[model samples]
Target: MTEKDIILTSEGREELEKELSNLINVIRPQVIEELVEARAQGDLSENADYDAARNRQAEVEARIKEIETMLSKAKIIEDSNNLNKEIKVGTTVTFQNLKTKKEMTVKIVGVIEADPFESKISNESPLAKAMLGKSTNDTCEVRELKEPYKILIKDIK
Candidate 1:
């Protein structure tokens, strides 16, 4: 079966590659050493160290596979020069909440790079979806909310 393409920024791709490298080059070797040391302790049935090492090996291997799969299917979102004209992935958007009269800024990024706490939202998110392709001063509705809220696009950069 084919996996869906994972959208990622260059930084997000780098982070995944770094994690995969660490798992393959460092964590895998360390876990192998742990397993070797555990095996030297004799009977595996009553050995807590042996069980722990085995568990760690399984987890590391699983993660390595997962990362490899993701990397294989990753589609990197490249930076665009038209960011100043319209909202798009990698663009920092400033908007105003019509109801609450609050102004906020958020960076639209691929799912892999999104961090809500840092005001970085994924393009797949409701707000970002509504705002995508809109230019400055355009109004958009947040459909995900129970009571739809209108947001005025203030700037795009």
Candidate 2:
């Protein structure tokens, strides 16, 4: 992917660390065991289990590499209590959609840890992109949906 530094919140960083540890200590050995078991079954050419295990192993290794790269390039966004200032990465912002009159709150986080379902949006996402650097009473436009939302930042924390 892009070489930009991977920005992560504290919780996101912890999740990544946990996944990395699991991959190295648990997944790698599990894949090795599968490969060994498959090999003991029979001829390579006719062995579906062996082929599948090999493919799984390759996928796991690739994922590990990607995680390692992310860790190496991680740029953690330190927690801030400066909510009186402008909204930024690691800030929880509250906004109201002018059209729908729907109010929502979201924590702006790094791309890898974004989960819109959980109200955690990526800093690079359109909504968070519009929110960043804005202050209370400032207007922003979010354009990810079919219809763009006109939002006013009501609060930042």
In every candidate, how many clashes are there? Answer: 0, 0
Q: Runs in model 2 with CA error above 4 Å?
A: 143-148
TM-score of each: 0.91, 0.90
Q: Rate the local accuracy (lDDT) of all candidates.
A: 0.91, 0.90
**Model 1: per-residue Cα lDDT at residue 19:** 97
Score residue 71 of candidate 2 by CA lDDT. Answer: 86
In model 2, state the lDDT of residue 65. 95
lDDT of 2 at 28: 94
- Per-residue CA lDDT of candidate 1, range 1-157, in tens? 2567988877788989999999999999999999999999999999999999999999999999988888899888776777358888888899999999999999998887899999999999999999999999999999885778999999888
TM-score (C-alpha) between model 1 and the true structure? 0.91
